[model samples]
Target: MTYALVRPARLDLNSYARATGLHPEAVRRLVALGLLEPVRDARGELCFSPAQVAVAARIQRLHHGLSINYAAIGLVIDLLDRIEELEADLRRLSERH
Candidate 1:
């Protein structure tokens, strides 16, 4: 059988902003706030994964839906992430029993 190599999608800052419908400056602000994590290329430019688009959308929802401030959004996102991790761990533990 022949194996196929698959590469994950990566988008630069501007593309990421366009995909998320946010301005590039806003994307940079998110990065500065640690709301989005991006990898740097050889040119030291921020590059985002496709998954981050979902994250940016989530951030928007939380901000607009709940009227949360950007600073507080960081805490909210961290808590949500932790809850997901805990749920995953619980599922794993339950599966063993």
Candidate 2:
């Protein structure tokens, strides 16, 4: 049997936002909303990933293009997260089926 691993390098919030044309505060808000995850170092400063920036950019698009409010955004993000988790679980189950 073979295993698969997916590992991405860490990025700082400023760098991530700069790469994706997003504001660090926007990404920070998303992290507070649980829509994005940011790691902290020994000093408790937030660090982001490139992929996290991408996700934040997409979220920004959704809000801008669809006029999504913060409350609605939070709900949608939560639902989408659950959907993704469920899909991953389903894929794992299918692999053993």
Candidate 3:
């Protein structure tokens, strides 16, 4: 058996903000809210994965298009987390056969 290690490209805060059209503060807020987990590079500065950058773009779109506030987004995220927890419980119960 062979194992493959994959590394995602790391993006700095400013570049990511420019690339995604999101304010760096907004991304920082998400980080503060536990929505994003930026990685620390060799230089000890915070950076984000490409996938996280992609999600930031999506979140920016949702906010810009729908004018959603952080509170609303937080609520939706909470509901989604509950739904995921319920689904996991359902799967566990079904596995009791």
Top candidate by TM-score: 1
Give the residue spans of candidate 2 off by over 4 A: 1-8, 81-97
Query: Which prediction has more favorable TM-score, 1 or 2?
Result: 1
Q: Where is the poorest 10-residue window by lDDT in model 2?
A: 2-11
What Cα-based lDDT does every candidate model obtain? 0.95, 0.78, 0.77
lDDT against true structure, model 2: 0.78
Estimate, for each residue in 1-97, the C-alpha lDDT of model 2 and write its tens digit: 9665875577787887787677888777777778787888668888776677667776887788989975588788778889999999999999999
- Prediction RMSDs, each to the true structure: 3.3, 5.7, 4.1
**Deviation of model 3 at 22, angstroms:** 1.6
Clashes of each: 0, 0, 0
Q: 2 or 3: which has the higher lDDT?
A: 2
> Where in model 1 is the C-alpha error above 4 Å?
1-8, 94-97
lDDT of 3 at 50: 76
Angstrom error at residue 15, model 1: 0.7
In model 3, the runs with Cα more than 4 Å from the true position are 1-7, 78-97
lDDT rank order:
1, 2, 3
